[model samples]
Target chain A: MTETAPRPTLEAVAARAGVSRATVSRVVNGGDGVRGPLVERVRRAVEELGYVPNQAARSLVTKRHDAVAVVVAEPETRVFADPFFALQLRGISKELTAHDSQLVLLLTEGRADHARVGRYLAGGHVDGALVFSLHLDDPLPELVQRAGVPTVFGGRPGWGEGTRSAVYVDSDNRGGARDAVRHLVGLGRRRIAHITGALDQTSAVDRLDGFRDVMVDAAPGLIAEGDFTPAGGERAMGELLERCPDLDAVFAANDLTASGALRVLRAQGRRVPEDVAVIGFDDMLPVAEQTDPPLTTVRQDIEEMGRLMARLLLRGLRGRGGEPGVGGTPSSVVLPTTLVRRASA
Target chain B: MTETAPRPTLEAVAARAGVSRATVSRVVNGGDGVRGPLVERVRRAVEELGYVPNQAARSLVTKRHDAVAVVVAEPETRVFADPFFALQLRGISKELTAHDSQLVLLLTEGRADHARVGRYLAGGHVDGALVFSLHLDDPLPELVQRAGVPTVFGGRPGWGEGTRSAVYVDSDNRGGARDAVRHLVGLGRRRIAHITGALDQTSAVDRLDGFRDVMVDAAPGLIAEGDFTPAGGERAMGELLERCPDLDAVFAANDLTASGALRVLRAQGRRVPEDVAVIGFDDMLPVAEQTDPPLTTVRQDIEEMGRLMARLLLRGLRGRGGEPGVGGTPSSVVLPTTLVRRASA
Candidate 1:
């Protein structure tokens, strides 16, 4: 390892290039409107001195860091255990790269990290933020609002006071759940059971609403609570079976939950689609396709949703003309979902 | 939505608090030696005015950003599709959060993005970098090396010149592969086939060497190329069966590839552990446990690897004592791997 010399500044570059400070600054900014000879000399001086532009100084002038903070508020590891967040992040990364920006990831553990995140956001280190998986009653919305940075939430946030004015991007969870239940109903299956995701998230609540939109008068024991994990799904399925053994169909909130239900059903000797039909949300090909009988699932464009979030934030940024919103709102978008029929249903 | 006010600066806080600029700076930078009354006055003024201390100005004085850049140089999306990288990132995030440092993610698509990453590291926006999934002949190592940032590669970099001095944290790929093959051999399965991940990657190459270490002089027909994707695993399985139909066991480079092989074997009516056996590296629970009859795979502590990467970098950062490495080298670490026995074999 070699020792690193102190980083060269604009003044040093100017001194080395035998040019004025303003000339060096103008050249470093873009080299536009500068003579070819002078630009070449400045470039040579910068290369010789290994002068990497100081972001702190540049940000002071430009009010931009070319960075966006992606705040994922998932305390549990199960969400990351699957590809859900990774896919969303990949989408966000692609869009940010296309726009020549960087992603600063802030993973929040719980209430303790919230203050840290709030302080970081308020510190003016980033131009905007793209937040994900915000739970009901989460203080992030209000904190971000107070910070005054442009933000786009991943899922539809739990409707609470002060969050109505917030902008977000989400999949049509309720509509997708409705379609899954409708498809099952059309298959002539009655006594349908619904497995719900963790109710803390708005997606889970909305999905439960979709399930009810179809089975409005379902039996009391037909609904089971799952935490969108295979283990949670397995336990929920067991509880549902104990309560309602005659249920002919199951609608799981997500593919992972559906997988667990399938495992338990297989263990209970209930053949899929013959004795019990199952449909799941989130086409999530890897899990959906690998199920004993390939899962019939509702497909939401997850990556597309992520891309839309970035696009929406970028649009808001442009609309504000490089200023944080002074007195206006950014519209939210809800992408649609479609049923992908497979062997299970 | 309400209009946002321009952020208040240090001068504003100083004026409002009726203190000198130096006193306000001292208060904002932690109030180490400031009087309690004066500090309280400055704090009240900052809160009342919603002042955000300029990171640019602070960094100019302290020469630190308290951020680490995590560079994932994977062009293919397959790795992200599974929980491999996600689990690793989760561990990294936990460690970084405990240290009160932020994570700045730099995902590179291909050769083009390498230059951008190089420039960013050179620009001194981050204190250190943790790079992942570097392939053979990749120029990122050289670029990062020249940038002179204290870096720790996630996996072992290709043995290129100038990379011998690089610090890294990796799993015992060869040892894990050896354990998997040994487990398969212990089951009395003759004519075992090998499914290698992308040979471009050092992990894959090392695993192949391990397989060769066990099955010295195995027939060429038993080896098939896979790009660590399920689809690639399926294709490789098909080709291996075509070349050597009697091959009784397989050692896939990763879990995703193993899942594909399991699918193909089931489709071909070859019962697992009866006529054929399968072993996979990376005991990625979602894929490993969900596979039909579960997977007998080698378990690398992925999350621990990520944690160690952050810890190693943090150690290096602290050792440098806030200076950019005045010529001291950090030792590399390679964690051990264990074979997890399950129903597949």
Candidate 2:
């Protein structure tokens, strides 16, 4: 982000007029309550220097850029390939666009980018920020917090403990996972296996917790760790099958993983929903709908979540740092998820 | 984009020092070739008014924002759903990150955004711009050209005719399509069909042109229009199959379209490669590799194209608009594509 060009400043105007900076500021800001002679002198100085009051006032006093920084702290660009990132960004972009605000997408890659993002957030270029800090140890949460800008996390921040007041918008990962597992139980699935996303992420952790909430006494062989990818799902599924060949149900962390699991199951000559049923999370459109049997998974309104995050942030910024949200401090919001039944389950 | 806050201007310092603006500029910029008394007077004035020399010089003279605008003139958010967008953006981001420049993404929606983008480019907020204007009727090319900013197009700009001097980086869509069709012909398959992408986009149009380059005067029933989506491919493939049941091979404009076509063929009990040798362009990894029998497609280096676009734009900006490329104008580059054969073809 950059300014158009250098312009005359109040300090310079005051220096030229041999007046105090405060007097120049007062005269420039409509000359309200300032002496007539002082106003005349300031006006003459401003005229000579070509000073534009609105530019300075808008940037300095009001501090409105009409731009919001969307910080994605993912190290890899693979996030772009995921429909979840796309849908969520669509939601955020639409919301911000509606508000006459520009979206400054800050794609932070690796450790070096952390400081860059931190500096950018603190640089006061954008009025506020909407960040995604999915991993448990992601430094984005702390850096953005330290930046002292009004920020809303895209998902639940994983910088655990003591930060209860952090504002966020997230899908009900635990509840959704619980519903997915319980749905399998309703189908009389006994040896139900769970394929987890990378444990480093809070969403994956919550999902695993949800699975545990239902199958408290399930065998150790029933749970397999995945990395929220098709390959990870395939590997996890293969592991679960080898350990417990009779597992009748598989619950994947996301649609991508589930798609991979589906491929593996088909390769092994198992009939989906007959010999084994599968349920994925995130109900990603093409992945879920285009799968061989289509996917029965938990539906999280990703775009809506993005829109809500922006809406919340804008609401917090409503009074321009005054009168905050409904209860003064903008609180975290957890959106509910739906179990969309399809042919797979 | 914003400034930190207003500070003392050189004009004001000159005024305070009772010297010429040029004298102040020279004194502030290291006091080179300026008289000692004038330099001392400017230095005192600068200190008194708290003016920063580098900030002014950087923003005004050199005009190095260290920021590049990536203007994606896409009305619908569906572009985000495409893996092509992800890969290209990843390439651009990585390149910009390496160059210590910020990627300021400008996602324009509908007619209103055209002027906004034009204004931003002309506003000189960024040092340069990388624009994507795929649709033939897109107003972006004209607007950006009118803005007079050094810009590089991500794809061949659709502002046809009299744009011979325009700089762009594109995959050899036509050549790639020709190769794909030629390969299908080598497989001893006649009565081949083609699934085209949305004809409005240059990539799709080029692919269609490429298909016709080989087929020449094939039956009208052999060509179907797809919107570069699996659903579109499915719809087009259904139409083609209905029109020409004896067609032995299918060439799709893109991987997404091919995926859709494959699904339709499978539902109709047609065996790929054996019954219909299927080929798709843009060998998108997961989409091409994950298909049932896998797909043999034309592989264009999308990421490399993105990197090259940035590189070209940066080259044009090398001397801050003084000197351009080797021949005074940055010439457009067209990257070659290769046929990636898998099980399907």
Candidates in order, TM-scores: namely 0.84, 0.73
Candidate 1, true inter-chain contacts retained: 0.22
lDDT of each: 0.83, 0.80
> What DockQ do you compute for every candidate structure?
0.30, 0.10
For candidate 1, what is the interface RMSD? Answer: 3.5
lDDT of 1 by residue, B267-342 (tens): 9999997888999998997789999979989999999999999988888888788556543456788889999888
Q: Candidate 1 DockQ category?
A: acceptable
User: What's the count of clashing pairs in each model shown?
Assistant: 4, 0
Fnat across every predicted model, in order: 0.22, 0.08
Score candidate 1 by DockQ.
0.30
Residues A92-201, model 1: lDDT tens digits: 87887788766667655455677667776765567788888877788888667667788898998776554776688999999999999999899999899999998999
